[model samples]
Target: MKPNGWIIYNGNLPGNKFLDYAEMIQESATKQGIDMKILKNNALLSLLATDQLGIVQLDKAELPDFVVFADKDIYLARQLELLGITVFNSSKAIEISDDKIASYQYMATHNIPMPKTIVAPKIFTTGNIDHKLVEKAIEQLGLPLIIKEAFGSFGEQVYLLHSLEEIITKIDAIQGKPYLFQQFIPSSYGKDLRLQVVGNQVVAAMERVNINDFRANVTSGGAMSVYTPTKEEAALAVAATKAINADFAGVDLLIGPDDKRLVCEINSNAHIRNLLDCTGINAADYIMEHILGVLS
Candidate 1:
């Protein structure tokens, strides 16, 4: 029998982007002859009872054979796993990917090539800026470094600071939030490559360039174009995905000095629309294919 599947996306998010991702996957699953459904994360309530752990939905729908988790609701994903439903990019992978610090730690453990990084100390409350620590980071990383919040997307929470005052001001504004500092790769200031990895291969790749900003995210006005990744690039992207135990992910690589490729970020539930627009390759199809292979 064909496997039953559900694409769980965030309903509370403002835009249709999340839904769009679910619909894309659903469409791909349909084409591949799999029974698929789109679900909103909030629609399923996780129940932790004395003798039973379950997911409660108002419609009383039966659980699927597997779930394509398109949201960051780790609890819900884990709840489904507890009930024996396979979750793509499992809860642990999603949790690690959702937090930049966790992701970096995993990368370091796996010896993934990345920029020099320093995890910021946890601050319990706002207005408590650790100037000495920030200075130390600057001393190690040098000026014009990058600061990234542990949890963010579309490059919105990443910052490039050129001075101590600017770093302090930015940190003060974002105190009480988990973040990290890293050496900025000036060679990749206006450009980077995004490779979508599925299973053990890179399904599609693109280069993003934003002459106007340090960040090369498409949402930050970066221009996209189809590109071919070198063998090493493809290998690195796949390795990064595996480092976090993700089934598939969008891995961004920064061009370091001497043409070295450094891992910039990994998105567990990366939006595929931009990639499709640029590469004419729908990652959803590859994802569905991978799921079917795993199920078989």
Candidate 2:
């Protein structure tokens, strides 16, 4: 008998990249003689109803053989796991990958060679800036340091502080949020590598370069082209993903001046559109296969 599979997508409906990936998974599963269902609903609410599990439509819950999470819905993923449903990239991994500071700390502790980072104290109310702390970080990490909010995506909240003045100004404006200050690796040249890892394997990788801007996120207007990673690069990316216990992920690595590769970040719910375009690899198929394997 074919295994029944379910993909939980954002309820926002079609036109979203996540939904597109869900559709591709459905198509791929069908080709492999598997029964696949795509449920476009509020992921959090869907997991609450025990009767909705195997049902494809509304208001049904039964234990699904496997649940593939396409959105960064960590809360719902955890609930499903509690119900004994197998989930790809488990909730614990998602939580770790979502926080930049945690991801860096995890990598560094595992000897993954991440940038030197200092975590700022949690801010409650805005007041005088911590000039002393900022000066200390600058003195240690030096100029052109990178400042990032603990939780950010698409390079939206990352900043390159070129001097102490910029650091103080940005810190003053971003009070009440924890930030990560790290040494900036200039060899990236506004370019970084995004390697897609699946089930402890690196399926594809691309070099995302931003000529006009410093951020390498495609959503930030960066351009992605295919780049074949060396054996060490591939191994590092795979190791980083495994270190975080992610079943599937996109690992970002920064190449330093001495040709040293540093693990920068990991995306649990990785966006595969750009990687697909660059590598011509059907990542959705890979994910579907993994889900089915788990169920089987």
Candidate 3:
């Protein structure tokens, strides 16, 4: 029998784009002759009781052989794993990739080349941050730095500050949240490479450029173009993916000094629609192939 699987995405998020990602994977699975179901994160509840510790399906649905977890619902991912169902990207990997601080720290141990970063001190109360630490970060990272929140996507929570006052204001606003201050790469401003890696290889690549903004995210009005990766670029992308123990990921690379590459971020459940439109390479197909290969 062909393997059946589930692609779970966040239903509460305000867009069809989340479901769009699921449908993309579903189409790929159909082409591969596999039975794949798209599920919302809220559709199946993660049950945790003394006697029963598994999924609680309201409609009495049977669990699949594997799950394509496209959401950052780490607890549900863990619950699925505990039931012996293989979750692609895995729960731990998703957790690490979701948090910017964790992503940087995890990549650091692997000696991955990235911008200089300082983890912001965690505070319990909002707006009660230590100005001294902010001053220290400014001293170490210098002016024109990037302040990024730990739990954000689509470059929405990232800020490029040019002065100590701006940094202090941004920090004060997000004191209780997990964030980090990093040295900004001037050469990489408004330009970066998004390399989609499947398994151990880069299956597709694109360059995002936004002349109007500091962030190169397509969601932030960045334009996408087909690009070829150098051997170093491909290797760095693959290494960053492996460091997070993710099966497949979208690795963003920044241009450092002398045209060197630095890891910007890794998305475990990266959307492939833009990649397909830009490079004519459907990462969803590669993702399904990776899933089937692992299952077999």
Candidate 4:
């Protein structure tokens, strides 16, 4: 029997981007003769009982054979797995990818090349900045470095520090939040490569460039174009994704001072719209194909 699937997306998000992701996947699944449903995560509740564990929905029906989880709600994903439904990207991978610090830790453990980094000490409260810890990081990564909050996306919580005040302002603003400091790769100042990996291969790649900002994220005003990744770049991206135990991911890479590839970041629930627009390749098709193949 052909498996029935549900594409779960976050309903709390204000914009349509999250919904758009689920729709794209549903469309791809449809084209391949697989039946799929788009369900908002909020529509169901994950609950645990003394002797039972399952997801509850108001208009509840049978559980899907597989779930295409396109949100950061790890608990819900894990809850589904507990009931025997397979979730793409898996909860462990989603947990690691959702937190930049955790992602970096996994990357470092596997010998992935990246910029020099320093994890900030935990501060449970605000208004008290740790000067010594901040200074040590600056001393190691140097001035004009990158400060990235451990749990952010779209380049919104990332900053390039040039002076004491800028660093202090950012630290103060995000105090009590997990974050990190890293060396800035000037060579890749306004650009990076985004490679979409499915299973063990890279299906599509793009180079993003921003003339106005240090961040090269498309949402941060970066322009994108289709690009071919070198063998080494491909290997690094594939390795980085696997290191974090992600089934599929969008791996960002930077060109280091030594002209070698350095891992910038990995996105577990990477939006495929941009990749499709830039490369005219729908990554959703590849994702659905991978899923169907695995199940088969």
How does each model score on TM-score? Answer: 0.98, 0.91, 0.98, 0.98
After superposition, the stretches of candidate 4 with alpha carbons farther than 4 Å from their true spots are none
Tens digits of lDDT, candidate 3, 2-69: 78999999988997989999999999999989988888899889888889988887566789999999
Cα deviation in Å at residue 210, candidate 4? 0.4
- Global local distance difference test of model 1: 0.95
Estimate, for each residue in 1-296, the C-alpha lDDT of model 4 and write its tens digit: 99999999998889999999999999999999999988998999998989879788966878899999999999999999999998998999999999999999999999999999999888777458878777888889888999999888898889998976789888888888999999999999999999999999999999999999999999999999999999889999999999999889999999888788999999999999999999999999999999999999
lDDT by residue for model 1 (1-296), tens: 99998999998999899999999999999998898888899899999979989988966788999999999999999999999999998999999999999999999999999999999988877457867998899999999999999999999999999999999999888888989999999999989999999999999999999999999999999999999999999999999999999999999999999999999999999999999999999999999999999989
Clashes of each: 0, 6, 0, 0
Give the Cα error of residue 186 in candidate 2, in Å.
0.8
Clashes of 3: 0
**Candidate 2 runs further than 4 Å off:** 12-15, 41-58
- Alpha-carbon lDDT, every model: 0.95, 0.82, 0.93, 0.93
Clashing pairs in 1: none
Weakest 10 consecutive residues of candidate 3 by summed lDDT: 122-131
Best by lDDT: 1
